[model samples]
Target: MLQMPDFLTLGHVTRDLHSDGSFSLGGTVTFAALTAYHLGLAAAIVSRADQQLIPELSRYLPNIELQIQPSPQSTTFANQYREGFRTQYLHARAESLEISDVPVQWREAPIVLLGPLAQELSPDIVSLFPRRPGTILAATPQGWLRRWDADGRVWPTPWMEAERILPQIDVLILSHDDLLPFADGNRRDADAILHRWSMHVPLLVATDGRHGATLFRHGQTQRFPAYPIDEVDPTGAGDVFAAAFLTHLHKHGDPEQAIDFANCTASFSVEQPGIAGIPTTEKVLQRMNEKKNLTT
Candidate 1:
């Protein structure tokens, strides 16, 4: 019998090229799956990538089960950061994922994260799983909100399927940057849009890098501050946050504590490059305690 995973993520695994001519495994599913694994869950990934990336994924995520749809090439990205702002380029894209790509047994996963990258996953992919009590379906919709020009320069595009997708999920996680294109960089406008979307989903979270995150629930909003840390690389921090929040929420059923744990997890992620910075549960709890001590 195939063992059902505790946490499952669907999307594309990316090959991220760095300025120093180095490359590493990336993508929202990559980070989120690793985060769940490190947090002591039996995590699995459903992604589309080239066969070459299979070995790399195995090395990084030793215990996690990977259901990969073979593609000629993996999704590829190059990021240029100038003065704390990042401009991204998409060089190659892998094959798109369909409902058929997901395993039958995995469909019953209690926790599912739709972590699309390069728009490889369609909005209808949400229907692949059964929605029942105690099941948490969360999405990090960054990929759906992105578009690239002829030169493959990536830019934000509105989430055109929000009306169709929002009501189907339990939690929605997105970054402030993801909202900027929709709100035209207007804070109030972004909050308005968030408020509107929050009504459809049970929980809505918007992460602002370093500054912290805001949570929307029961038609009310609460802000959670990011844990302070000297940064090394911010790549995959939002994905890390979403995974941590969902994992904690699934186990403890407390959004407030989940966000605090997520904030601490994300803080640790930025202190190192790639998934090396993702913290263990003990480390996150230690950081949480230290923060409480300072405040007390």
Candidate 2:
């Protein structure tokens, strides 16, 4: 029997392409799996992608266990950015992940990160895991909130299953970018929607890339400011943050402490690129200590 990993991520691992034709391995599954490993968790991934790309993905992920379903083509994304405006295109998509994809032993994983990138996770996933007392079910619902045109241009859409899904999730993490379609770039509108959703999600986090993130739980809200860092690429910072926060919350059960750890960890992710940017637990602790020293 396969040993249960501490963190189990379900999603479609993607190939991120640049306009110049160079591509890198990306997706929440790729970023979150590596982040969990660096944070000292035994991580595993349930994803769908082209069989040939497995070796390449493994090269970046190293020792993490991969339970992949072979697809004719891996989900592919091309991101174009100009003057801070970003446009995304979906080149291909993998199959949806069903509850049956989870291994029996892995069902009780202490932390399960549902990070669908292309609406590839089944809605039934909310009830698939045994809700053991302290288990954490953290979801990044961008996939469910997305809509793509016939030409494959991706855009944000309302999450139709929010009522059914939010009540089941322990922690819900989303970025301002994910909520843009509904909020129409208005901060007040975003906060209004977040306030409404917070009622259902026990802990709801809305991340704003540099300004920081807000945590809403049980009818109250708290803010944590972001750490300043020279950014090389902001690619997987959100994934890193979500993984660190969920793992820390599982171990510590303190949202404030978890958010601080996540903020510090994600700051380092933007300093570099891809897996190279993920900070080790030791590095994260060291930075945290340094911050404490400056204040005292």
Candidate 3:
């Protein structure tokens, strides 16, 4: 194996099958890793990208540290929807990461983001680093609950392992709908359920469509309004937002700046399709600068 890069991303890789003529590549791992690279971070990705997709995945992927694993079968996803509503289905097995696969050089790194696509990604992955240094950002429960039927329709399953995973996450991000599985689809009851979910995670965020999102940290609630935009295809917007948010937090160490940057980045993402919507860090900065100028 080549020397593993010090910066790493643990997440999923899925073939995003859409209704349009476009069969694009997607996943938290792809968007986040790429966003980090755009922001000048040394980045690496560990995911299941079989022989076939690896060639394609390599092209869009910059020359950086990459770890590819063979799967029983490559993981595939069909994201089907009409208008703004959407549903997904899984068609194949995604790979899993053993503790042994984590690079020794990364043992001391201060930042790691845990992102997953399907059920194959386990909370047990966190156990791989008991003494590992720094923060661990987890896009969980949302990732943990994903399951696909034999016919490729994605649905929710019990994330029995979430208890183990929650305690391991420093920052957790999920959509308001992602809480449905745990809340039994009860929107009104999600608040109580989320409170329990946040006990283990120091910072927790839940985004609710155009209604905006909630941030819970240090026993206080802060809400940020979602920038209104005509969403074209919101495929990877959340992942991109999380990537931008994390980049800001890591680079500037300020909560408000991170949220503002993240909101702008995410709003920018929804204005286009797939990964094409992910803007560069400079674009994000420029947009923020514009917003600040108008407000002032």
Candidate 4:
């Protein structure tokens, strides 16, 4: 019998290339799966990677079960950061993921995170699991905002299915950067965008890096402050936040507590690089305890 995982993420595992030709394992699945594992959840990933990259994947992905769809080349990206700004380019893309890719047994995962990094997952994939009590469905729609030029220079594209899809998601995680195109770089414009999107999504978040994140639910908006800490690489912090929030929400079923735990978990992720940044449950609880002590 196939074992069902507690947390399951759907996306492509990426090969991130640097200017010097060095590559690292990346993508939402890579980071989120590790975050879930560190949180002590039985996690699994459904994604595609090139056959040649399996060994590299095995290095970072020891305990996680990977449901890989075969592809000639993995989804590859190059991100160049200068003065706090990043310019991203897509070098290659893996095959699009379909609902058929996921196993029947894994459909019952308590926390389902749909994190498509390159528009690889089909929208219809949402139908796979209907709304069921105790089962949460979350999505990070970064891929829907992406459109690459001929040279693979990635730019934000419009998402057409907000009305149809957002209603299906229990938790929708997005950053200010992810919605910038819709907001036209204006902070005031972002409010309108968030308000529009929140009409369909019951729980929606718009993160603003170190400052904090804004949560919208049931027509009420609340701000969740981020923990201030010295930062290193912010690469997977958002994915880490998404995983932490979903895992905590699954276990605790309290959005306020979950966001607080997630913000605390993500604070640690920005302190290190890559998967090394993901905090263990012990570390997160330690931070939470510290906060409680400070408040008391």
| Cα-based TM-score, every candidate | 0.97, 0.97, 0.89, 0.97
Candidate 4 is scored at a TM of 0.97
Over 1-296, each residue of candidate 4 has an lDDT whose tens digit, in order, gives 76999999999999899789988889988889999999999999999878898666767798998888789999999987899788899999999998889999999889899999999988899999777899999999999879999999999988887778998879899887787777778887877788888989889887889978888886578998999899998888999999999999989889989999999999999998888889899999999999889989
Candidate 3 TM-score versus the reference? 0.89
Q: Lowest lDDT 10-mer window, candidate 2?
A: 125-134
What would the per-residue lDDT of candidate 3 be over residues 1-296, giving only the tens digit for each residue? 55544346776677776677456778888877777777667778887767877777778786656777766656777766679667777767667766666667664445567777776566677766553334545564456777676787878776677667777767777777877766777986777666777776778877776776778775467888877789897777777767777777767777667877888888877898777777778888898788789889
Please give the distance, in angstroms, between residue 250's alpha carbon in candidate 2 and its true position after superposition. Answer: 1.0
Model 2 lDDT per residue over 1-296, tens place: 79999999999999999778878889998899999999999999998888888768778679899888788999999977889888899999988887888898888899999999989987898788745687998899888988899999998889988878888888999897677679888888888888888999889988888988999986688999988889898998999999999989999999999999999999999999786889999999999999989889
By the TM-score metric, which is better: model 1 or model 3?
Answer: 1
The global Cα lDDT (0 to 1) of model 4 is 0.89
What lDDT would each prediction earn against the true structure? 0.91, 0.89, 0.71, 0.89
**Residue 176 Cα positional deviation in candidate 3, in Å, after optimal superposition:** 1.3
How does candidate 1 score on lDDT?
0.91
Model 2 misplaced stretches (Cα beyond 4 Å): none
After superposing candidate 3 on the true structure, give the runs of residues whose Cα lies further than 4 Å from its correct spot. 1-7, 20-22, 82-84, 131-134
